[model samples]
Target: MYFSIEPKTSKEDLFNFDEPYAALKKCIGLNEERLVVVFGLRRTGKTSLMKVVYNELDMPKIYIDAREIFPLTPLSTNQYLVSIFIEFARKYDIIKAILEHVSAVEFVLRAEGKEREAILSSILKNINAEMQKRKTHLVIFIDEAQLLKPTGADRLLAYIYDNLKHIQIVVAGSEIGILEEFAGQNKNASLFGRAKKQITLNRLRPEQSFLFLKKGFAQAKKQISEKELMAAITEIDGIVGWLSMYGWHYLKIGSKKALETIVKDGSKIIADELEAFLSYRGEARRRYLIMLRTLSIREMRWNELKRTLELEEKKKINDSHISNYIEALVNYGFIEKEGINYKLADPLLKRGLDFVKI
Candidate 1:
């Protein structure tokens, strides 16, 4: 199931995390609760690792994907928490009895007046009390939590974490912008400085990447040529999500064009994120595209990047403008700083240079 291109929610598919798992076990140990945030770039196994930890922890849990509930089809905060409550009730037999009296959860889904807020809060408190009685932690996990809106959910979470000792809120976000701006280092955000622990997942090293592919293929009852697979790993760059996609394709066609799979199928997903990062810039899209393309080729100092953009735009770009762009790109995960130089985080993104223009 590690080779599954679709979502894999089981711990059995988890790999290379004896250290991270153990650390998380210590962080979220019995009654040692805090708001935990797991962050990383796309294709890293943030969700899978959380599931692995979830399986190990003996607690009542609900995993809500903000990507589904927030963007594209936005859900109000009431509806969001109500869904979590429903899932928790469904998972625990004891909560099913309380579910019958939870008319407010159903009513607040459509109506969000002050009265509704109080009603929903009371219900969450009631559920919290029941969880405490059972001596099991009430863990609510929100994946892609960057998509979560500023609906005072954090205030509610802060209230719960401070008062309801049995409740724990763990969120994971793949986009750096969402994670940082929403909860990390940002002083003004609700959960800022409140995350009990923060864990970042990085791409596997070369040897680990090889073993990951080998084991994933074995899990799927398929085989891959060692040479071709290594070449594919080079192309995929230790991104497990893309590897899963490539393996899914390899099983069908028996081909070794993992780079092709990444560029063709995965381009839009990456481009969409980049575009989302540059969404606020009105006339600077072309500059960003040219700069990203330039860095994709090689790392460049600030002066060099500014000169490249000047030549590309056929207009003078001030030093401050280019510096701001570089900083923003680095912060948003498109560009990484190496010493005093900057380069695209994923060189594979160069293949979609055209998409960046729009």
Candidate 2:
């Protein structure tokens, strides 16, 4: 009752939900040429933050989920060009204004499957012209941005980072390591040699979470003990999504022993989420995830991973195969490398992985 866990539609509600709002304001103020990459694990509420910022600002904004635009499969360059045009159509007179600047408007309209670099160049020029006239910066927030790699448009991102002077782009994805992979370690990589601002979304602290639950409980005219709050927070480890589900459970049960029920139900909920994530992945991914979980208990070196694999019941892992598995896992946001050591990307996911295994 009176809980705020849904997608935030307004500015005030979004800022008040969680995390520091002041820092967001500061980030928005820095509308430099460099694209700001805001990424975290799944369910970290990056989309909510973008929606809030867009609503607060008066500038014309366009938000798209890159997952929909760019899936796991490869897409033609023409298709990429079309998606950009389609997204711009949402804003009034935006597309029309762009088309007005180009002399070969019919050429862009008629282009089919594959096209020349010239057509793409013309489209970019018109769009850039429209962007300049508005003096109103465009914020393109791409959710699930890792989906774009298969399209080979990862370089297109570099193009935008280098050329788009008027638009302030913000790309968000669940996979931190993979997104960085697209950005590449090379100096020529777009956004390479440029300062990157990373914002990590961690779970709520126990005190803050308890305060939230207490406030909600008070509003519902129900009383809950400090012990109960502590117990619930400990079980969920202050994950907002899990905590919100627990609140929902408490509201339904309304029992003196709500804490125990909430913990039981919360574990099931977390397990269900893990199952959904794991279901889509393969055995190699699973093994990689388990390896990450093992490392999470304590940091593991490359040699240690090799030794652990060698001690396996039967098969020995090849270096290439191991590298590929590790890359896929890291790309999907399951495993992370700190120098030569590795760990799970999120501690909550680590706990869920550990719990689900048994």
Candidate 3:
């Protein structure tokens, strides 16, 4: 169904991504690249695209959601690695081999630090050998890969890309800059200077957004006025996640309640995300919030935003600091630059800023 909240597995339910879908399928099918990176802002359907391709592919595959292992610690990382090995072993009916390779299942679970990483590398090496013996490729999809940075999975990903030719890694992340950093798009990283297939998903245009809502409501067999649809489109804009949520809620409640609920629900969600982003920023957190809250009001040029921040602090702020702050926000997908002005990326973010304290 169009309004279903889960990541889409079927292409029939996906909308307006024909080019990307076809391109991704071809990229994975040809197996020309060791690494594929799918990049996009939040709610632009990166996960749905990944899931759909995963379902259609006719090869051995594994999908890992790194978000599940967040707040990464030695124990959690160890357990996650064991789980991956267990899944792979069960899929290939190689439980006996894995147990023999590790000597005991408990050792796999109890190992930590460098020992755990060595075990994971050994497991992948074994899987690669098995795939080579079978003469098949194993496609592994790691979603939200930016979260895996703390776990040092990038080194392992590099290892696979370098040595395990039969194992292909596809990673997707909503935080574009962070994902790139994790994937070695920057210098001095493990996978730097390697060939990679990159795909990006973007928000729908106004016309496309309207058509999406029209078709979605039609599929649901619900009646919604054109005027109401336009209002929802204006408020929600082009993000598919918000559009799907609004449609789902409209089917359950009425349009009025649905829109109200989206505001309440979306604001809290974005606020919580912003809070998480700020948690480790220390003194810079206040500056980020100020810049974000200011931009939430309206788009502003660099000088104007700096002036606003200065006024709020009643003191001078360095130009370099202002530049860094704007750059950080843009990298994190919170605000974007158009021409000389910077504005919040999502319409709902303005309302979300109201819920943020300071």
Candidate 4:
């Protein structure tokens, strides 16, 4: 079960993070006032934690992955809202009436601008009224919520948090910087100054990773040597996703082939993600790549990295420019700072870098 590479919905399949699991469960069960935000590196089990808590709690709730309904236009944005509204109605056992009203209004394909806003607001108000009548609460769990930024759905979340007394919102995202921005960690945003509870998932330690792999393999009814386990731990570090992948693959092939497959497959996935990240960062993409490539070789202090960047570019890049680049990388969870040095947050990103073209 541990080696099953899916977002775990059962606590038994989860490994460690007992404190986070307990805290999150209590927060939702008690209907905490503050919004709950779960943050972590991409494969550090944020989804698993969120889903596990959602499944354990007995409440009126709906979990939506914003990535699936990412909107491309105003019409699509309204459609997304209607989708959420319909899901909420279904969860509350009001879908029959809600669909009747939705069809009568023809809001799906026609609603736009203020009309869409009004319809969404009305839907939430109605849902809140139903919850009040039933003397219950509704929790909206959104995964990868940063994807909703451009759709202006954060403002909708802000409205729900402020007006609906019986509704609680929980969101999880791997992109820490963007997720914070979406949640109005910035000064000028809808959710600005709003109270929030945050839970961050970090990579496992060496011992934890070893035990995780050992236990996972045992559950699979296979045996692995300590030396082989140590090698996998050393290479994959502490990312649970990679550890699970290794364990799952080792059952079919041997250790060497599994590691190689991880590097090959994982790098491709990370490469596609890095490419997407860079697509939004105009002209400065090359500079970011140079910095990442330099750090990929080894960790470096500020001055050392700056000198390397300047040398590679054959031009004197300003201190502020270097600082911004490094800050962006750190914020995006691509790199981490220790003492006075910076390095890739995941070792696999180095192999990913090989696939990235300049």
Q: Rank by TM-score, highest first.
A: 4, 3, 1, 2
lDDT rank order: 3, 4, 1, 2
List, residue by residue over 91-154, the lDDT tens digit for candidate 3: 7876655565555446756765777777777777778788888888889999999888777778
Model 2: weakest 10-residue lDDT segment is: 69-78
Candidate 3 deviant stretches above 4 angstroms: 29-31, 95-99, 110-112
Note the residue pairs that clash in candidate 2: none
TM-score of each: 0.85, 0.74, 0.94, 0.94
> Model 2 segments beyond 4 Å from truth?
1-5, 11-20, 29-33, 70-90, 100-121, 184-191, 216-222, 253-286, 289-306, 314-330, 335-358
Q: How well is each residue in 1-358 modelled by candidate 2, as lDDT tens digits?
A: 3345565556543323544444554555354635667666555566667667666776656676775552344434345555565457445466665554244434545654344445555566566667677665556666666667666656666666667766566767777777776555445555467555566665567787888678767767888888877777766565565566566667876644455665555446555655665676666545655566567678787767766765652568788876766776676766668898876654455555646652
- Over 144-200, each residue of candidate 4 has an lDDT whose tens digit, in order, gives 988788888888889988889778899999888888988889887789889988888
At residue 299, give the lDDT of candidate 3: 94
Stretches off by above 4 angstroms in model 4 are 29-31, 95-101
Clash count for each candidate, listed in order shown? 0, 0, 0, 0
Worst 10 residues of 4 by lDDT: 96-105
* Overall local distance difference test of candidate 1: 0.73
Q: Give one digit per residue, the lDDT tens place, for model 1 in 1-358.
A: 7777766566667677666666666766356556777877776888887777776677677777766654333236667677668667766866665665467666776665666667666767778788877876788777877666455556566677777777787888776765666664677776666646777788788898899889988887776689977888777677777877777778766774555766676777787778787788878877888889888778899899999988877889888898778877876677777798887776567765667765
lDDT of each: 0.73, 0.61, 0.85, 0.84
